[model samples]
Target: MLPTVRHLLSQPDLDLRLLTPATTLPERALEQSVEWVHSSDLSDPTPFLSPGQVLLTTGTQFDTEAHGDELYTAYVARLRQRGIAALGFGTEVIRDGTPDGLVDACLADGLPLFEVPYRTPFIAVVRSAADMVAEERYARHTWALSAQRAISLAALRPDGLSATLSELSHQLHHWVALFDASGTLDRVFPRDAFAGAGLPGTSFETVQREAGRLLGRGQRASATVLAGGETLTLQTLGRRDQLRGVLALGGVRELDAASQDVVTSVIALAGLALEQNHALAGARGHLRAGLLHALLGGSRDLAETISTEMWGPLPSAPVQLVVTDAPAGRLDAIIEFLELRVEEQPDRLFFATQNDRVVLILDRTGRLLLEDLCRTFGLHAGLSDQTDYRDLPRALAQAEQACERSKEGEAGVVEFDDISRQGVLAFLARTDAREVGRATLLPLINHDELNGSELLKTVQVWLQHNGAFDAAGRVLGVHRHTVRSRIELAETLLGRDLGTFHARADVWAALLATASVPG
Candidate 1:
């Protein structure tokens, strides 16, 4: 490490002594390693001074009578403002000694002040600091090279990005995270360390906003955030103003140039990985679409052969067709997420996008993955019954219809069977169903409108109660006799027998169909 004030004071040959009280000097200040030394004969040296430097002055300009106490105090304050590690005063040049105003100013500001005897030359101090700085730089170079090698080897592992991040986290002894362009957390080293570090509640929103802005510009940007009593640095991952993602590093430490080089290399690798994945996804999407076309055209044998070569043997019996929809803004993210899932488990599914919807031919058991994805992405999805590859066209139609129905109902997922409607009569097209519903209820609707009778309410309540007059009456806040009379009137007006289960079922379907229609 570079030499600090304490290190210089401890060198017996240097003959340096602390003029500031030991109690007054903080441990952080004493441990600060000086990067260099600056010797100035001028009074105002703030412009020349930099951080992590020990300022050396011979007190030749310390004329209390000429400069006044206030001017000396101002000079000392300026040195502190420039962030000098410490101030060294050389005695014997001034007629008196170190000015009391300078000493008082250093003490007030907690700036470490030490005295240099005339016997010691400032050049000696400069030499000691330079050697230490060079040694530290070399050490950092060695460590960075080793870390880069380790990270590179880890990236070659089968696990790829996860393994690379793990190795980096281990080497730095800090948490590392990667986020995709959509601002989703793609991976985090040490598992749940990000949450443990209190980052989610502290700076997650800011990070997401900045990440989105940087990604749009395809540029590199960074922000420093404080969380869990430690600093985190969030940086964009890109090259030449093309951003693919963002990276987060917590418990940040000052990195040397060599270490920063390793970071740049890692960022490059990550960007390349993302680009390759995107290209592969596009190619796979085309293949999946082609496969669907073959199956829909009744070329089952060709489809199966291609499927076997790419994603293992096709299910001989039947597979489920799933359709998914998301908002236009989130459509790309949802598609990318599905593509990743397909790549990770190729045999489980194959998917392609059609317009605003994603269609998938997946094993029956893959429903859970779709359900979870729907919830995660706030998507609406529809699933069809298992159908043979030969019947994929029909199955796809069913799934598309279900997906649209789910979206209309604002449901997360809708399975073909969940609607409990079989064959063509289950539910017709929107206009047809509305017309049929209006016809079915027209007689009773007109009667109630003309006579202001409670027949429609009574029939609906009776249907809910399964034709039980007493239960229906209780729900309607009326007596069983009144409910019975209302139901009879409804039956007369509709010219149907409400006593039969099939008849009531028909009326129930019509009621649901008209529930969403205006009178």
Candidate 2:
């Protein structure tokens, strides 16, 4: 321990009289050698002492009566130029007091003045300075040890959580945990220290409260554990964004100042490492999503990647197609979660998230998985007819149509045939171009005003039977001649012949269009 100047002057029994009480002393640092002895005897003492050295003085070298002011002025100038550490004047030889001019000079030069009492020994002052240095070293060493232990509390082995947490618990001598944002333990130390702490396995929302706590006033607080018979101090181990975790340390040493810094570094490192791993995995998932999109976007076959990999074979696949996205913003987590669920289900051939929802081609023998999926995902699904792998596009279209129909009115999953009203009622819903082509034959539909005109009814019957006059007469409850006359009247009204199949088709189509229009 090197002695400081002020500490050296505070010793007992040196008989050093107080000299310059008002002189400004220069700053003093520790001296490694006894080289300060040479400067003690010089007339202009400061020129011999190194800059920053503490220069203690006695007035023995100067002839005060004849040369006092000149010698004093020279000494002050040299002290100022050399930057001596607070020139101390022992008054024993200089008339028991520092000269006023020297005091004023020291003050103007901005140096510090100390008055050493007659009872203090300069040697005793040296020993005291040495003691202070030793104490400071001890304090720094203690702080460093605490820092090491704090870091160890958050470290782990590559094996997994149990080993890491157990070691941390032992190091901190308290239970420690790395919880997801949900306050559910992602990992815990001491194996059994955390029994059922409600760590969420699949969602971070549950731990958001804990995360918020760590971010706000921080997790540092005193915990009274009656069962364990120990009081623990909790410290948040990271900044708001980095590795966020609650650190539990036993015995209330309070993690010291150095430990906090160490914990900050450790948490930052953990956050970085975890994020890097997540980013890499996300990149892989992105590649897979891109590959799926390319397959679904074009005419390319997905045979080599789809059933061949995710599913063993595509037999009797109980497939469902879905199409919905959150209206608020783009769907991200929900989409990924649903896709994961497809793989986890009991029997799924494979799942593809194209057109917003998963199109699950499942093993028909295991149809129960579908119900479970719908319940879990809370999404509407369009179950399609189990078809061959090559026919997936057709099945997909049917499922999409069903979903569209659901949007039309149902507000739930749709079936392919549920919206297929066009089969039996095709003519009722004909498009405008077909309806316009039949406009010329509308006159036959309105000819019932003619006398004894079974003509309109006959035309209707003939059109209904596809121009079969015998069937038309049977349907009309009349003879073939009556049916023929009606057809002739219909032809006359329209100024056209209705004897042929082509003319019959035109009249029938017109009657269909007239029936479909709003009355």
Residue-wise C-alpha lDDT for candidate 1, range 243-282, written one tens digit per residue: 6688876764654467567777777777777777667767
Candidate 1 Cα deviation (angstroms), residue 281 = 1.6
* Each prediction's number of clashing residue pairs: 0, 24
Which residue window of length 10 is worst by lDDT in model 2?
30-39
The lowest-lDDT stretch of 10 consecutive residues in candidate 1 is 422-431
- Give the winner by TM-score: 1
RMSD (Å) of each candidate, 1 decimal: 4.8, 17.6
Compute the lDDT for candidate 1.
0.76
- In model 1, residue pairs whose N, Cα or C atoms come closer than 3 Å (at least 3 residues apart or on different chains), thus clashing, are none
Query: Compared with the true structure, what per-residue lDDT tens digits does model 2 show for residues 400-512?
Result: 76555455443345566654543423333343434564466445434545454556566666766768889988877888887777676677888777767677666555555
- Candidate that would win on lDDT: 1
TM-scores for every candidate against the unseen true structure: 0.79, 0.36
